[model samples]
Target chain A: MPILWLFLIVLAIAAAGYVIGRSRAVASVGGDHRKMHSLASFYGSNVAIKVFVPAFLFTIAWLLVQPIVVNATVSDMIPEAAIADNSSRGLVMAEVRRIADGLDSAVAAGGMSADFARTPQTDLDDVTQRIKDAGGVVTSDITAPVLNAAQRYRAMNGTGNFIMSGLAILIALGGAWWGIRESHADFRARNTVETSIRALLIGAASIAILTTLGIVLSLIFNTIEFFRLYPAADFFFGTNWAPSFSGRGGSSDLGVLPLLWGTFYISIVALAVAVPIGLFAAIYLSEYASKRVRSVAKPLLEVLAGIPTIVYGLFALLTVGPLLLEIFGKDGLGWMQAGTAVMTAGLVMGIMLIPFVSSLSDDIINAVPQALRDGSYGLGATQSETIKQVVLPAALPGIVGAILLAASRAIGETMIVVLGAGAAARLSLNPFEAMTTVTAKIVSQLTGDADFASPEALVAFALGMTLFVITLALNVLALYIVRKYREQYE
Target chain B: MMKDNADERIGVDAMDIKFAAKDVQVYYADNHAIKDVSVDILDKTVTAFIGPSGCGKSTFLRSLNRMNDTIPICRVEGDIRLDGQDINAPEVDPVQLRAKVGMVFQKPNPFPKSIYDNVAYGPRIHGLARGKAELDEIVEKSLRRAAIWDEVKDRLDAAGTGLSGGQQQRLCIARAVATEPEVLLMDEPCSALDPIATAQVEELIDELRQSYSVIIVTHSMQQAARVSQKTAFFHLGNLVEYGDTTDIFTNPRDTRTESYITGRIG
Candidate 1:
């Protein structure tokens, strides 16, 4: 059965369970709901959840496991001699799986009979021609060993799916039966439902956490593989960043220093621009602006954060870059060679991060209790004096945390750096020069038709892992500072 | 009813009026929060404003120092003179006016700084100290005056927020006194404190009265009787009576004041 149809069938069973479970509880209490331990809907939902949740979980597990089991059993049927030269067993297994699908579709399209598809004596060329006429993708003419493997693959999948459907439905019915039998006046349906809901929420939360863990694990493994092909010391300490793209076995200079420096330099420039402007804007909004002005200005400032970084990248490329180049490039001071440079990307990225810093700092500044301001004013301190002496000091840790978080964002940002900062892994102090960051390099390294076994392609994972570690550390520090500050006032 | 003999009870010639508010009507947006109210707060005396919640006692006290100016919706009409000078005059800077009339809030609001910095904040802002040494002297003197010198004299570098509740309140009082204001307004300064802290603050208020005109707004009638030399009872945004504290408590006057003091209605 199709998975969707199976889902609908289970849903229908759960729906039936709901009605029967509610009526069972009502009948147990002589049709008076007040005598029951929980509301009538609670009883109904309890049975529905029991019937649906486990059966759906089982269906998903069966779907995921059946393919692996069928693939393992069928791939063994193709003998080693049937495999072609310079190709892998895994590749031949892929061909067998595709042939299995094609044969199934050929039978379905009525171009071949089911008995002919199952029989081993059927002409191989005739089966291949029928599959091609049925518009199935086949790499080459079907051979006997591949055909036999495809047949076995199809049969096992069909039987596994049939068993899965039967078992899932049986479990749903069994759960519904138990749920209805337990539906009595004294049964605590609400408590059971509460526990299930709690488990559901926990499951949802763990999905997010587990996905993060999965990403980290994947990055770690690929990075380890990249290191195995390249010297770790050279990758970390080498000043050069020339990745030679000469096929699978080429020597590449995958140094991280130049990229790290560029990332730091751009981030520093961005922070230098963002921190003061964002902090001043936050202070004005939180302390000096009238209520009418604040209500309008705050959202207007926050709108900057809503603009996509890609749009900012384009702005840097087409607007700010040229504007700066006209003054500092060859047309003017002759200090810069082109519009795309570190200064262009850094400035535009700063503009992108202003709202991020300002919005967060504004909230942190506002969180400084009004009583502290009142106390300062009552001491004859002017507004600015109070803010400088009391408010800013009180909100210092949180503001620093906000700035650090923005720094992490600047480090991880890709589009702006890719477009505005020219992708040249150069170690230069001059702001007008072109440079690239870890994220931009990762994108450039992964986009082409490069062999994955080479250090050139696998280095992207290492770069990604580096970026992730830096950002994660920054985030952890920011959270620590913000949390410590909160405990001060709370 | 007793005659309006406020002049006879305190011997008016000996006491100097520090603040005099005449026909002070306050409105918060459209709400007439404080009706036509007038009172003379004397110098070097503890005067307490006693009333139920939202009776405009704190409002009237805040108006004395123009602290009500912070609220955007709040408006004050009429004259509040400090030592015969109209404090609301356009040329009179509220910041300078606040320097002469410092306040302590209902809750202890110690700045998130060291004990020394918390006390030195006002003095530094007002430029009252000539140098670091003089600023240190002012801090020490203020802490001594607020009666928290002995307990916190050792941990001057420690954060004021880490102090106990009573200690923090006294530190706030010290912060207020550091400015050397002529009049000190306390809005229920002991409300967030325990009885022990309350007694400590009440004692500080009495000591502070020797140098400053102390105006306190409190909810406890017994607190008014215990700490104040002059008492004003407000009811429904109106000042029911203002006179010597002893007379307001012991003598028959307005029936509303009687009902409030005797706990019949608040």
Candidate 2:
């Protein structure tokens, strides 16, 4: 049976349980709802939950476990003599699984018989041709041992699925039976349902947290593997970043310093452009703008944030880069060699981050207690003087946190740098010179005909780990500052 | 001796009027907050505006320094003169006027700066001090005058917000006085303080009467009697009575004032 159909069957069982449980509860109270321990709907929900949750959980567990067990049993059936040199057991297992799927599909399409698919006497070429004709993928001609393994794999999977379907329905029926039996007036259905809901919510929240943990762990393992191939000291401190992609054995300099420098320099430039403009914009919006102007202008300013960074990358590549090139390119001031440089990327990234800094700082400024402003104005200070001396100082910690968050954003930015800043990692001071960031290089290292085992390719994970650490530290610091500010005010 | 002197000074025409309002009407977004109120505020005296909550005493006091100008919906009509010059005139800047008429709010709001910096803020913005030495001298003098110098002199670098409720209010008073304003408007400055702090602030207010014309808005009728030489009772946005403190308490001319003072009606 299809999993969707199984799911619907379970749902139908739960629906029946709901109706039976509600009516039973009501009958136990002699049809008087006032005498029931909980509402009729609560009893219904309790039965539905009992019928659905455990059964669905069992179904999912079965679905996950069945393939692993089938693969292990079927791969053991293939003799070691049939395995070729320079290929892994895991690879053979992948082929076996694919061939098994193909045979199943071929049988389903009426090009082959179920008896022939399960039997060992079928011709290998004819079976492979029929599988291919049935629109199933086959990497190579099937050997006798492999064909026998594929047949066993299909047999085991079919039996496993059949058992899973039977077990799931049995569990659903058992749960529904137990729930209906417990549907008396004294049963605390509401509390039981409430506890289940709380557990469900906790399960949801933990899944999100666990997924993040899993991603971090994966990155950590890969980074460790990369460091095993490449020297840690060289990766961390070496100034050069030239990765020779000729082959794995070739000497490659995977220094992170130049890339780190580029990241920082571009981030500094971005911050330099963003901080003043963004802060000023925030001040104008929060302090000076009238309600009419603010209602329109605040959202319009935030609209800049809503524009995807990829679109900004395009704008940087097509418009801002060329515009800057016209002023500082070789034909003009001779300061820039091409349109794509650190300054081009930095400028566009700054524009992209303006809304980030402005919106956050605006909220921070607005959060500064009106009492402080009142105290300043009461002292005969001008509006500008009041904001400068009182409001800004009170809002300073929060604004710094906002700026740091924007800084992290600038450092993590990839698309803008890839399109605007050229893909050369150079340790130069000139803003107009081409340089690349860690994220940009991470992109470049992974997306070509590079060997996965090679340091050049695995270095993407290392770069990712490094970038993650830096941004994570920045986020922690930002949160710390913001929290400290909140404590001070409240 | 101070009480005898205050009584002797009352009703004396020799005293100069610091602020004179003529038929001042204040409307906040079509809500008539202050209605046709007029009173003469004398120099070198503490005058109290006493009323129930939402009775417009604070509104009338805020109108004195034009603090109401900060509220976009607030509109002030008629003439209010500071030292015989119309403060509401187009030529008069509210900023400069605020320097001459400093205010302490109902709550103790100290700037999020060091104690030294908080006192120096007003003088620095107004350019009252020519140098750091002069600025320091002014801060010390103002703090000393506000009676907070001794408590905070050792830790002037400490954040002003770190002070206790009463100390912060006194620090605010010092900050206001640092500008050397001719008039000081205190809107229930000791309301947030305990009895001890209130007494301390009341004593400071009485002392402040020596240098500045002080107008205070208070909820407590006893606080008005304790602090002010002159008392104005406002009822329902109307100035029901204005007289010497002793007469306002002991012998009120209006039935409403009598009822309010005797706790019959608010």
Candidate 3:
């Protein structure tokens, strides 16, 4: 049976358990529910939890562990002579699994009897032809040892699935019987059900945390592998970033300094454009704008944040790049060489980040207590002087946190740099010069046709690890500052 | 000895009027908060406005310094003069008027700065000190006048907000006094202080009466009687009676004032 059908069977058993458990609890106290330890729904939920949880857990575990066990046993059955010199054991296992599936389909289509297909003396050509006629793909002519391994793979999988279905249903039935037996007036069904629900929620939360850990572990291992192939010191300190793609073990100078410099320079330019404009906009929105104007304008300003970064990337490429090129190109200032330069991406990314800084800074500024402003005004200070000396000082730490978050966002931006900042890794102070960031280069390295095990391709993981560590540190610092600021007033 | 001296000064300085108001009315968005009220505030004395909550005593006091102008919907009408100059005139800026007439709020609100900086804020903004030494002298004088010098003199560089509630209020008083204002308006200044702090602040107020005219609004009738020389009783936005503190407590002229003092119809 299919896994979906088995899942529905377990649910049906649990549903029956719910009805029986509720009725049994009531009947135990002569149909007076007031004598029960818990409510009627609680009793029903307890029974359903018992019947569904364990059976579902078992089914999942069987599905995860069966393939490995079966593959290990069946591959051992194949002789060493069947193994080819060029292909790996994993590749042969994949072919074996595919041929087994094909044979299963051929038998299910009535092209051959099961016993006849399993006979060792049956013609391989005949079985292959029958598999092809049954609409199964055959990559090569069937060999004797591969044919025997495929048959064993099919037989083991069939037995494993059958056993899994039977055991899951048996567990469900046993849980239902035990639940109904315990469904008396004195049973603490409510507490048990509540505990189960709490466990379920904890399980959900841990899944997210565990997934993040898994991603970090994968990045760490790949980074270690890359370091083993390429010297760590050279990768970190070297200035040149030229990757030769002729083949593996070629002369490739993979340095990270130029990329780091480009990332920092572009981020500086972006923050220069974003911080002042965004901070002033936040001040106006929070402090000066009237109620009616604020209600209309705040959301309209936030609409800038909702625009996709990809759309901003296109704008940087098509519009801002050309505009800056005209002003600073040979005709205007003779500083820029082309449309794609650090200035173009930085300016456009700053526009993209305006709403980010404004929205967060606005909230932080608004969090400042009104009594401070009142105290300042009571001392005969003007409104502007009060804001400059008193209000802004109180909100400075939180605003710094917001700016750091925006800085991280600018550093990790990929599409904007790819489209606007040309794919040339260089270290220069001129904003008009084209430069590439770490994220943009990561995309280029992985999408190329290099071998997966080569250092040039594995270098993407190292770049990813570096970028992740930097952003993570920035986020932690930002959160720390924001939390410390919150403790001041409350 | 101080009470007799103050009484003798009141008799000798009967013509020293510091503030005069005529038929003043206040409105907050069409809600009449203060009715027609007129009073003369004499210099070198403490006058107390005593009333129940929401009786417009604080509202009327705020109008004296044009602090009510900060609220968008608050409006004040009629003429109010400080030192014989019409403060409502367009030629007189509210900022200058406020510097001339300072205020202390009910709660202790101090700036998040050093204690010395808190005391020097007013003098610094008004350009009363030409040098750092002069600014330091002004800070010491103000803190001493507020009667909190010894407790905080050693920690002048400490954060003003780190002080106790009473100390913070005294720091605010010092801040206000550093400007050398001719009048001080206090709105329920002792409401948030304990009995010990209240007595201390009352003593400071009595000493302050020797130099500047002080007006205080209080909810406590006994507090008003203790700290003030003149007492005004307001009920439902109306000033029912005004007289010497002894007479107002013993021989009130209005039945409303009598009922309020006797705790009958507040």
Report the number of the highest-DockQ candidate: 1
Q: Candidate 2 on A1-490: residue-level lDDT in tens?
A: 7888899999999999999999999999899999999999889888999899999999989888988888888878888988989777888888888999899889999998989888886578999999999999998778888888888888898888889999999999999998999999999999999999899999999999999999999999999999999999999999999998885744899999999999998899899999999999999999999989999999999999999889999998999999999999877898999989999999999998899999999999999888888888888988999999998999999999999999999999999999999999999999999999999999999997868899999999999999999999999999998888676765
Among the numbered candidates, top TM-score falls to: 1
For residue B78, give model 3's deviation from the true position in Å.
Answer: 3.7
lDDT by residue for model 3 over A1-490, one digit each (tens)? Answer: 8899999999999999999999999999999989999998788888888999999999999999999899999889888878788877777788888889888888899988898667674588988899899888888788888888998898899899999999999999999998988899999999999899899999999999999999999999999999999999988998988888786745888899999989988888899999998999999998888879989999999999998888989999999999998999999999999999999999999998999899999998898887777677777877777788778878888999999999999999999999989999988899999999999999999995868799999998999999999999999999999887676654
What residue pairs are clashing in model 1? none
Query: Over the stretch A88-143, how does candidate 1's per-residue lDDT look in tens digits?
Result: 88998888989988988999999989998888945778888899988888998788
DockQ of candidate 3 against the true complex: 0.56
Model 3 C-alpha lDDT per residue in residues B83-115, reported as the tens digit of each score: 899999999988888888998998888877789
Q: Against the true structure, what is each candidate's TM-score?
A: 0.95, 0.93, 0.91
Candidate 1 local Cα displacement, residue A180, angstroms:
3.5
Whichever of 1 and 2 has more DockQ, that candidate is: 1
Interface Cα root-mean-square deviation for all models: 0.5, 0.7, 1.2
Computed on C-alphas against the true complex, the DockQ of each candidate is 0.83, 0.76, 0.56
Q: Per-model C-alpha lDDT, please?
A: 0.91, 0.91, 0.89
Please provide, for model 2 over B101-215, each residue's C-alpha lDDT reduced to its tens digit, 9 standing for 90 to 100.
Answer: 9999999889889999999999999899999999999999999998989999999999999999999999999999999999999999988999999999999998998888999
